[model samples]
Target: MFILDIFSLQQNIDFSLRSLTISLLLGTLLSLALKIHYQRFGMSLSNRVAFSKVFVFITLTTTLIISIVKSSIALSLGLVGALSIVRFRTPIKEPEELAYLFMCIAVGLGLGANQWLATIVATTIILIVTIRWKRSEDQSLFLSLDWEKSHNIDLDQLQNCLLKFICDCDLRRFDSRDEREEVIYYINIANSDNLLSLIQKLKTDFPQIGISFLDKTTIPGV
Candidate 1:
């Protein structure tokens, strides 16, 4: 009886199989593209692979959910309930990760809705633009630093050391709490190798400092 019902339902939905197949393919491709984009832009290395998995899973799940839930009220209430129960305790440290997550979700939704051509076209354009932006010299690198015994450091000397390696640098944020100062720098370098050298110098000069680096490919979350 159940198998017969399943067959009947499958026959009734005209594009069910097509939508599912396309959604899966698009979700996989889009997730890969977004991951490549994030890496190219030098996003934070920590939890990146895990985050990509989450992004892809969310995209796939949301796509199927949107496709199956037809009634507006049911969809709205179900979404609310589903979201309410979801507690993401892991705070996303980078804003760009949030953006990529959303983009993946959008691509999934588009594919689920049978907007295949649009999804492909839009994603290609975005990928191209991101690649070009990454190659440009105007992009800034984000640096996270934790200075131990903050009083031991001289801001002028640190700035001079950084300036020697980069063409332009700016302090984006500084937080001093619990005997540690967290400093973030936006630096424009002539090349990616130069950026790595600057980070190495920071470690060599101040062995006690904890340093992390990311680039412009970050996305913001709501």
Candidate 2:
């Protein structure tokens, strides 16, 4: 009888573990869905990936903690302590990133509560709507031009040249030191090929000018 009881307990434990695993898997799927939907917008690719990975781990761990353990007081205290000490050092400049993080956490919680179907259905609808919204807008382009301090180029003339090539141009930032200025331009162009051709012309016209092109993937410091 004792052996039979032990076998029954083992089966119950296995069933519970299987349920938890399914929950975590559903959560991960929901997170991925959110990522795909957000990517259609002007979201930073690398930042999105990093946020997704972090949230997935966080949700999975939280689900495990809340499921297997059945102590409300301990859970409440742990949550308080966790929130009190948590700090994010890396600066998240975009507000959209924070929204995505919250969505990921919500899906995880939903799955942990054994609401896998709801999580999947809700995420799917959200992704569809986001993709539709992205289709309505044009993609944005960024161009950065860096030159040596010693170069004596006419900034006004350069700006004129860029204005002719792009639909709109703005001086986004300038890093100046020792009489040197690294000017960054945020341009809205109808086509990327036009921007490339413009850069080539600039290179040909001023071979001595230290000009560079950058995209969304380029980091500010690097």
Candidate 3:
């Protein structure tokens, strides 16, 4: 009897198909907007285009799931149980990517709960603030360094030297298995003179090292 009570379905509310359709359409549009904003204003060094492609799908799926479950208490409990068995193993490489994903989920949840006005207003405000903040931040450049393994470069020394000329350096990739080693970095250069100084210093200190600078427009489609 208790088990039956636990599994019993509630009298579903009079759900509105028209409202669901409207929420889905709005969610789709918002997702696309989020995707574009992320691709343009995001600071992550990963593949923004590929990462953001899931936004629309995630938003719609979330909205659909929430709309279906929200009408019944039993279904909501069932959802919790169903999700308990699911495991998301894909790692998020950057915090910014995770934040964007959360925003996508928020849009879905808000619209699903029929808070369309709040969702739209909040999302717009957040995007505007994010764009302004990102624009105000320092500019960064993609830098690639390659050298023979025989050069025996010290990474710590290289980074220490980098700090003298750049505001910050983030090492994105490193490979040292072959005779040739390579490193990728996102560096913040304050001015052209600092950039020139860094280049000349690298040439003098590590003559065998190869240096390359790639702008965002040129590399990995951003």
Candidate 4:
């Protein structure tokens, strides 16, 4: 009697040149489109060019992960465990940024699964809706920050924080003495809730500092 094994352990990994190439190409193009859409229509207080990389990186990594895991159930489980252990401590200041990141991940998931057509179509629809929505609601808001500096003050960090929560922040004034300095910033933002929230968050983060926003139009001195 000849004994034959019907179920064998196959460890070999195979890549289809055509499918891999098409998926990656689609992912790259879709990510680029998302980056552009975000830069042009993003309503966040900070729209730094450096942030665009988040979309590109997330999309490509997702694509790679999905592609690699598709061939092995073992690898897919490993990915889940690895991701579960990782935690991000940094706060996401803008909801829109988080939404975009999620969209990028979705694109990556589709492409990695070799669903190129659906990824492309979905991306297009999302971009159109986001742009039009932003256009429909157009208003300008601004914030002003003034503080008498202390020895513990971090000038660069303060500026960066302002940029992160406001559309544009300019250093209108700065006066320094032996042990202290006075600083002023004029910020452009569009949401009253966000403005109040930012002020409260800043107060909580830096209790020693003075932070407030005033009505620019009512202020007499320019």
The TM-score values for the models, in the order shown, are 0.59, 0.56, 0.65, 0.60
Candidate 1 lDDT trough over 10 residues, lowest sum: 67-76
With a 3 Å backbone cut-off (N, CA, C), the pairs that clash in candidate 4 are 45-166, 141-189
Ten contiguous residues minimizing lDDT sum, candidate 2: 40-49
lDDT for each residue of candidate 2 in 134-210, tens digit (9 for 90 to 100):
55544355666666678877778888888877788888887878866677887666544465678788887767666
Candidate 1 per-residue lDDT over residues 1-222, each given as its tens digit: 999977776556444666687778887877777776665564354566666767677778767876665324445576889888988897767776877877888887787777789988998898888767766745467878887665578877888999988889899898888888888888877655576688789888988888887756653530
Residue 21, model 3: lDDT of 99
Query: Higher TM-score: candidate 1 or 3?
Result: 3
Off by over 4 Å in 4: 1-14, 143-222
> Which digits, one per residue and each the tens of the lDDT, describe model 4 over residues 5-87?
21221334455768877888888999999998877677654554568778888998899888888887767788999999999
Q: Candidate 3 — worst ten consecutive residues by lDDT sum?
A: 5-14
Candidate 2, clashing residue pairs? none
| 2 against 4, candidate with superior lDDT | 4
Answer with 2 or 3, whichever has the higher TM-score: 3
lDDT of 3 by residue, 81-185 (tens): 999999999998767899999999999999998899999999999999998998667657888999889889999988888888989899999998769899999
lDDT of 3 at 194: 69
- Count of steric clashes across candidates, in order: 4, 0, 0, 2
Each model's C-alpha lDDT? 0.74, 0.67, 0.87, 0.74
Order the candidates by TM-score, highest first — what do you get? 3, 4, 1, 2
